[model samples]
Target: MPKTFYQFLMTQRNPESYDTIANFANNAFLDSAFPKQETEFDPLSKYLEENAPYLPSMTIFDDAWQLYLASLA
Candidate 1:
């Protein structure tokens, strides 16, 4: 089975590459309203843009997302 977004983020391939994203994922995991299961980008993007503890560049998200998509295959 494919991992959830939160699951994927928490499972680090390279600890250094995901430092910021892992921090955000930790935060997101705590939030009751976070859409942890949804794989679609737009809602997740909006949530990250608005609710992140610190603003991470969209490029970081895009790269993470590409990896997530590949994992689904």
Candidate 2:
């Protein structure tokens, strides 16, 4: 698997909301708030909800996350 978000993409081929999505994930990872080992469900979605009060709206997170996943395909 990729080590970092940048490495994961390995290219600029992403949707318009890619940066926003990546920023959140990278920050969450860097801040030790991302549950990297959680296998029961989607970590990104969980992180976004857990940090909703401290970050932007869930709509943005949801959109960006979906776009990011699409870009990976």
- Candidate number with greatest lDDT: 1
What lDDT, from 0 to 1, does candidate 1 have? Answer: 0.71
Tens digits of per-residue lDDT, candidate 1, 1-73, equal 5677767876743434447656555656567777778778899889878877554587777777888888888
Candidate 2 per-residue C-alpha lDDT over 7-35 given as tens digits, one digit per residue, 9 for 90 to 100: 33224333344475555544554555445
Please provide TM-scores, in order, for all candidate models, with all chains considered together: 0.67, 0.44
Q: What is residue 27's positional error in candidate 2, in angstroms? A: 3.4
| Model 1, residue pairs in steric clash | none
What are the lDDT scores of the predictions, listed in order? 0.71, 0.49
Best by TM-score: 1
lDDT of 1 at 55: 41
Off by over 4 Å in 2: 1-26, 37-43
lDDT of 2 at 72: 54
TM-score of predicted structure 1: 0.67
Clashes of 2: 0
